[model samples]
Target: MKTQTAFPANNLMGVSQPDLKGNGQGGIFNKAVKLFTVAEKENGSLIDQLSGMRASLDKLQMNVFIADKDLNLIYMNEIAYSTLKAIEPEIQKAFGLRVDDLLGGSIHRFHKDPQAVEVILRNPSSLPHQAELEFGNVVLRSSINGIFDTQGQPLGYVVNG
Candidate 1:
């Protein structure tokens, strides 16, 4: 004789049950769809919040920038762009003097310990790491960290002064 367990026809979230159809592909597909929808919702909200915060950084005097693993510029707030422009006026006409148009290339000009910084960015053990940079006569203190996804995979790096 065979015994059967009674599974609910619907999930707690009120998601309708998918037809198992013996192979169970339909159920897996339904679950995948649900997971993706949830993820999209969460990411959307997070993006909105982060956008506000990124814009707020523009009001501050300190320089802030984010770069990819290869050290390519990603983003810099208004203050940071203006700071760069003050340091190098020609930069504004060359590359719009915007977020990604800093120092003609990478941020390696300031980050003296690129190797250590890369290591910390790729794999942040616990807390963030601190480093100092000198640009012209200004000394900037920065905290560096790896931008990670839900699965803890490194996305890039964020530098804040």
Candidate 2:
């Protein structure tokens, strides 16, 4: 006997759902369609607006990182990646986490300052903090803030490099 689990419908905001045909690719296509469709409908293209902003940030001389209230990285600009590469070895040595680890999920690996880190995560409006890394060669300036929706409730953070 086989048991079945009920999966939620694809409600990614505004994207469309793909067909679930006998072909092996239908599920994947459906997911992609739903994702994009949902993104398109958010606050008259909120996701697209953010995506455009991200693109502009890539061209900036400075780096940027958007983290959540948990201090887990949501996204990083290209310059940020460059800076991370500059200090890759030291980052890994000191925190034992690769640069990619910063991009959301499981950040306990590279952060040595738990209290300070926690503060930064919890207090989004708190003042920015400067820290010296494991090697002391890289200088990272960080700022955190609560990203509110139209209703002004704390959602995540609009962190920066």
Candidate 3:
């Protein structure tokens, strides 16, 4: 008679266990797999919730604009285009002025005199911050907050509702 030899294959963790037939072990293993599956499902759900929150923020009634430190428009949410009109093009389109000329200073254009664009750039981040610009029956109100990057350098601006 010839001798017979059989060895179990290694699992992902490099451990080998006997391949036993059906029993209560199958139920325990199935439950563990179900827990992992549920965990993955929860992770997926959380990602979807975050996505929805972003979409809702974008669709908000308040016009919002994000700009680089140089005042170049990097992002303009939906309300921005609808409410601010040329405001977006001035920052995003670059119009006819060179990049250097367009956004050379900052996004707080109206912070100083509200009508002082053709001649100056001013720093006005003091208290009672507000701006009023007339635009076809509907008034435009803007509040600006400067933003800095992780390096603690002024990187951009955040225009809020």
Give the best candidate by TM-score. 2
- Looking at candidate 1, the ten consecutive residues that score lowest on lDDT are 5-14
lDDT (Cα) of model 1 = 0.48
Rate residue 86 of model 3 by lDDT.
35
Query: Each candidate's lDDT (Cα)?
Result: 0.48, 0.48, 0.39
Clashes (backbone N, CA, C under 3 Å), per candidate, total 0, 5, 0
Among these predictions, the greatest lDDT belongs to 2
Candidate 3 lDDT by residue in tens digits, 93-149: 332333334223444443444345312222323411354444223334555544433
**Model with the higher TM-score, candidate 1 or 2:** 2
Candidates ranked by TM-score: 2, 1, 3
**Candidate 2 global CA lDDT score:** 0.48
Which sequence of candidate numbers ranks them by lDDT, best first?
2, 1, 3
Q: What does candidate 3 score in Cα RMSD to the true structure?
A: 26.8
In model 2, residue pairs whose N, Cα or C atoms come closer than 3 Å (at least 3 residues apart or on different chains), thus clashing, are 14-37, 14-38, 15-37, 15-38, 18-30
Candidate 2 segments whose C-alpha is farther than 4 A from its true place:
1-49, 106-108, 113-116, 124-137, 150-152
Clashing pairs in 1: none
lDDT, candidate 1, residue 109?
47
